[model samples]
Target chain A: MPSTAGAALPERSRDLRAFAGPVVEWAIWIAVLAWVFWQTQRFDREIAQYAFGAAGWPRALCIAAALGATGQLIYRIAEIRRGRAAVPEAAGPEIAAPESAAPEGQKPGLWQRAKHLPIFIFPLIYLYLVPSVGFYVATPFFILGLLLILEVRTLRALLGVTCVVYGLVLLLFTRFFYVALPVGRIESFYDINNAIIGIARYGM
Target chain B: MEQFLDGTFNLFGDGQAVLIFALGLIGGMLFGAIPGVNMLTLGAVLLPFTITMQPEHAVMLFSVIYCAGVFGGAITAILFNIPGAPENAPTCFDGYPMTMQGRSGKAIGAAVSCSAIGGVASAVLMMSATGLIASWAVRAFGPQEVFALIFFGLAVSASIGAENLWKGWLSVFAGLIIATVGTDPVGGIPRFNEGSFFGLEFSSYYLSAGIHFIPMILGFFAVSEVLTQAMHISKGTRERPKAGLDFPTIAEFLSVRWTMLRSIVIGFFAGILPGIGATLAAFLGYSQAHRWSKKRANFGKGELEGVVASETANNAATGAAMIPLLALGLPGGALTAMIMGIFQIHGMEPGPLIFVNSGDLVWITFAAMFWANLFIILLGWLQTKTVVQILRVPFRWLAPGILLLAVIGAYALRNLFIDVWVMFLAGIVGYLLRRSGYSAAGVVLGLILGKLGESAFSKSMQLMDYNFFGFFERPISALLITLGIAAIIVSIINEIRGADVQKALMD
Candidate 1:
C-alpha cells in the first residue's frame, strides 16, 4: 500500500506541473485587462455623461474581460484543488510541444522552436528592404532567402522557381493591373519596369 | 422569378462577363486548392485590380471566386489530408482515408456533384429569402434593433470559440479594444493614439488612418499559415494519388440525397446566423450524417457520405452567408466581410437599402453565383487530373510564393508602408493568441462588428433619450437581446459541464 501510494504521488505532482502554465497565462490575462481598464480613465471625461460616450463601451468591455479572467483563474484553482493535483495539462499543446518540459518526456528545446523563427523574421527583413531596394529588386531575394530557410538546397531549382514566381507577379501586378509597386530611391526602376511592360505588350 | 431569369440571361449576354466569370472561377480554384492559400487572400490580391473594372464585373468576379473557392478546398483535403481552408477541415476525415484506399475518384466525384447541388440550392434560397429579409429589416429595424442583432452575433461568435467560453469573450473584448484604437465612429475623435498613451510619432498617421481589414486578414490568415507550414518543412511528402474522372453512379447519388438536403438546410440556416460560418456548418452536417447513418462505424474510414456531408454543407454556406451581408450589412464570416469591403469600394453599401437602391445588382450577383456553381462542377470535373496535381507541389516552394503574395496584397491596400507593418504586427498577435487556445475568429468578428455596433449603440442612445432600459421597448430588439442572454447562459453551462467532465476524468 505504501509503494502504491508513493507511485501515485509523482503522478499527482506531474499533473500540478501541467496546470502551472495555464494558471500563469490566466493571471497575465487578468493583469492585462486591469491595465486596459486603467487606460480607459485617460479618455475624455467631459463626455462621460452620455450613455454611449467615448469611454463608456470601452470601460464596460474592459470590466467584463477582467471579471471573466478573474473567474477563470478561480475556477482553475478550484479545479486543481478538487482533483488533488497540482496542475492538469495545459491546452493547445496536444499538437505541438508543451510550454514546459514534462517529467515524463522531452520537450521541444529553444533551438528546435527557433528553427521556425526565420519564417517570421524573413518577412520582416523583406518588408524592410522593399522601401529601399524596391519591390522588383527585393522580391527575388526574399523568395530566394525563404526557399533557403525552408531548406531547398538545389540552387538550380531555387533560381528557376524564383524567376517564374517573380516574373509572373511582376507581369500581372505591374503590367496588367498597373499597381504602383514601391520603386525606392532608384530612378531607373520605373524605366526597367516600363521596358518590360512594353516588351510584353508590343513585342521586342 | 422573371427578374432572376432576366438577370441570368443578361449576365451571360455580354462576352466580357463570361470571360471575367471564367477567370474568377479558374483563378479561385487554383489558389484555394493550395494549402495555406485561401479565398480571402486571393480576393485581397485581386481587390486592387477590380478598381479599374466596371462595378458589375468586379462584383461578379468576386462572387464567382467566393463560390469556387469553397469547392476548391476539398480537392486538397482528399489528396493531401491537409485542408486548404478551415471550412474543409471536416472533409479530411474521410476524404484522405478514401484516397489511401484508392477510391479517390469516387470521393472527388461525390464532393464535386454534391458541392454544386448544394451551392445551387442555397443560391435559390438566398434569392428568395434575402429580398424578403431586407424589406422586413428596412421596415422594422432601428439602430436599437441593429445593435441587438450585432450583440447577438458577438454572443454566438463567442460561444463557438475553440476553447473556454471565457477566453473567447476575452478575445472578443481584446478585439473590441483594438477596434477602438482608431477614431471613434460616433465622435470622430482619435482614442488610444500617441496623445492618449505614449508621446510617439510612430502612431500618428497609422493610428489615425486605422488598421485596414485587408492587411489584418492577410496577416492573420496568410502570414500565420506560412509560419505554421514553415515549421513542418522537415516532414516528408506523400506520393500523389492517381486521380481519375470517375463520376459517382446514380445509385450512390440517390443514397446520399437526404443527407445532402439536410446538410444544405443546416448550412443555409447557419450561414444566415452571423459569425457562424462554413466551418460550423461542415461540422454540424458531418456529425448529423454520422448520427443518422446506419453504418456509422464506417464514418471515418472512407465513407462517401462523410465527404458529401462536409462538402455540401460548406458549399451551401457560400451563398447563404451573403444573405445577412445584403440584408443587414452584417458579414457572417471572413469571405463575406471581404465581399462587404468590395461593395464599399464600389460605392455601394450592402444594407437593406441596397435592395431598394441597387436591386438589379443584387439579382445579378445571385445569378452569377448560379453560373459560378455550374462552372465549378463542369470545370472541376474536366480538370480533376490537373487540379489534383497541385498536391504534389512542395510546401517549401509554395510557402514563399504565398508569403510574397501576402506582402503584395498588404501593400496594395493603401500603398502605405505602415499597412504592411500593421499586417506583420497583427500576424504576430494572431499567432500568439492562437497558440494560447484563443480563437482568432472571435477577435475578427469583434473587429468587423465593432464600428457598426458602436454607431448603432450611439444612435440608440440618442433615440431613447439616454434611457438604457428603452432598448426593451422595441419588440424585435427585446427579443434579440433575450436571445443573446440565452446564448451566453447556454455557453456558460456548457463550459461548466465540460470542466466537470474533465475533473471526473482526472479523478
Candidate 2:
C-alpha cells in the first residue's frame, strides 16, 4: 500500500470518524444538561422542601459549560467543514530496522495472538485468590508465575526475588503495621502463630 | 505579640512537636517521591496515629505533612517522567525534559528552592491576610461568584491546553458529567444511580458519589504515564544524567527569581480564594510566567524559569490554601480539607471563633508549616541527589509495582476491591484522554469543583428565591464575576493571537 502524503490526503468529505468525535461529545453534553434540568425541575415541583426555587450558580454554570462544549463541537465541525480535520497524513515507505530486531511477524503480543486465553484468565484467577490465600501465600506464587511467563532467566532468580519480596511485605503489613492477614478458609490446617514465629525466627 | 512568642516557644519547647515535624518531613518526602501517594493519603493515614496526641502536636504534624508533601512531589516529577501528585502534573512536562538533558540536579534544586520560597511566601501572606481574606471569601462568594470561580479555574486550565483547546474542553466536559453521578446535592433526589438495573441498589448516601482521589490520581498520572512509557521502551534504560545537586548560578538565580516571586504572589492570591486548588494556582503561574518570560517559546521544552514558576506557585498554594482552612474551617483542596477534618476531630473548630479562641495554636501550626517547608528543602535536596537513580527503574517493572500499590491503595481507601477495578477502568479512560491530547488537570479540577458548584449554586438560588441577580447585590460577588468574564475574554484574545501567529509562521 503506497503511503498518502500532502495532496494525496483526503481533500474533503464527511468522514464518519472525524465527525463522530464531536457529535458524541455534543450528545453527551446535551444529555447531561437535559437530565440535570429535568431532575431539578421535577424535584422543584415535588416535595416543597426539595425545591431550590430557581436556577442558581450551579445551573447557570452548567448551562455555561454546556454552551462552551457546544461551541467547541461547533469549532471542530467548522474544521471538518473546511477540509482540515485529522485527515491521515502520508509518510515514506516502511524500512525494517535490522532483520534481527524483531523476528518477522513475531512481535510480543499485548494480550494474545488469536485469543491466547490463559493470559486473560491468569490475572482473573489471581484477583479471586488474592484475599483468600492472603498476601503472603498468594504474592510469591503470583510474582513467580509472572516472571516465568515473561521468560525471565533462571528459576533461582525468580524464586529468590519473589521470596524476598513476599517476606518484606509480610513483615511490613503483618508485623510492623499490624495489618491482619486473611488465613484462608482451611483454618484447621493453617496456624497463624507458626507463620509469624517462623518469619521472626528466621529473617529472609 | 505575647501569643506569638508563646507559640514559638511552645513549638521549640515540646519534644513531641519535633518528632511530629520529623515524621511529617519524612512522610511527606516518601509520599511525594511516589506517584499516586499524595499528601492527602499520607496525612489521613497518619491522622489515626496522631489522634491520641495533643491537638497542637497533631495539627503541627498535619500542617508539616501538608506543606512538605506539596514540595516533595517535585522530586519524582523532576527525576522521573511521572508527577507524584496531580498538581505536579504540569511540572513533569518541563521538569523531566530538563532531567533528560542532564540538568536533573539543577531542576531539582530549582524546584526545591522555589517550593520553599513559594511555601514561605504564602505562609507570610496567610498570616497577615487571613482575617481580611476570610471576610472577602464569605462576603463576596455567593453561588454566582463561586460558580464563576470554578469557571475561572476551568478557563485557567483551558488556556494552558495550548494548541488543543477543543480536546481540553472535551475532557473537562467528561469530568463534569462524571461528577453528576450519585445524588443531587440540593434536592436530595437520586439521579442516575442505575438502581434495580443490575440488581445493584447502592446506598443513596454513598451514591452522592464520593469518588476516591488517590486511586484516580494514580490512574491518571501514574498508570497512564507508565503505560505510555512502556509502549515506547527501547533497549536497556539509560543511566540518569549526573548533575550532583547544585544550585543555579547567581545570574541563573536572578533570572528566575522574579518568576518565583510572581508565581508565589499569584499562587497565594489564588489560594486565598476559596475552592481553588494547586492545579489552578500552577496553571495561572505557568501562563503568567510564560507571558513574562523573554524566551516564552522555551516554556514546555524544559525551561528552568518555567519550572521555577510552576513549583513556586503550586507550593505557595499550600499556605495560601490554609487561610480559608484556618479562618472559616473550609478546606481549600482535598488535603487541606482533610486537615479541616482533623481540626474538627481534634475538637478544634476552625472559624472566626478559632482565630479568637485558638489563636496561639494557629500560630503554632503556621510555624510548623514554615519549618516543614525548610525541612523539605534540606531533606528533599539531599534525597534528590540520591533519588535520581530510582528513575532508572524500567517502566515495565515500575508499572506492575505501581499497579500492585494501586490495587492495595484503592482497596484500603474504603476496603473495597471494587474501587480497585474502578481505578483500573479510570486509568484506561484517563490514558485514552491523554493520548488524545486532553488535559487531566481539567478533569481533576472539574471533579473537585463540580459538586461544590452544584450545592453552592442551588443554595444561592434558594437564598435568593431564584432571583439570579440576587447574588450581585453583594459587592464581592459582582467583582469576582467581572474578573472571571475578563479572564475568559483575555484568554480568548491571547489564544486567537497565538493561532494567528502560528498561521503566519506556517505561511
Return the top candidate by TM-score. 2
Fnat values, one per model, are: 0.32, 0.05
lDDT of 1 by residue, B1-507 (tens): 987897787788889888888889988887677654568767877888878887778877888898999888888777655456767766766786676566777888888888899899999988888867545545677789878877875775562323456776877777777777777766676666654234433346567776665566566655654564565553222233455446779999999999999999878765666665576577667767865776555665678998999899988988888887888888877767777877888788887788789877787889999889977888888767566555457757876777776677677767788888887887787667656666455565566567768878888988899888898999989998998888788767756665323223434
Query: TM-score of the A chain in candidate 1?
Result: 0.70
Could you give candidate 2's per-residue lDDT for residues B1-507 as a string of tens digits? 465567667887888777777888888878777654567667766778666888778777878887888777787777655567766766775676677667888888888888888888787777778889878866765667766666666665653532355555556665665566656676555544443324544344454455655566666656555444433333222233444456666788798778888898878877776667676788778767876788665665568887898899998888888887788878877777777777878777888888788877888888777767776778867877788766554333444455555555566666655565556667666655554455665666566666777776666667777777876676766666666677667755644443523222322
Residue A123 CA displacement from its true place in model 2, Å: 6.2
DockQ of each: 0.33, 0.15
Instruction: Report the CAPRI category for model 2.
Output: incorrect
Which stretches of model 2 miss by more than 4 angstroms? A1-70, A80-138, A141-174, A178-204, B1-6, B49-52, B159-163, B195-208, B234-247, B273-275, B290-296, B328-360, B471-473, B489-507
Predicted model with the maximum DockQ:
1
Q: What is the lDDT of residue B506 in candidate 1?
A: 34
10 residues in a row with least lDDT, candidate 2 chain B: B498-507
lDDT for B330 in candidate 2 is: 81
For candidate 2 chain A, which ten residues in a row score worst on lDDT? A90-99
Evaluated on CA atoms against the true complex, candidate 2 attains a DockQ of 0.15
Q: Could you give the C-alpha RMSD of every candidate to the true structure, in order shown?
A: 6.3, 6.3
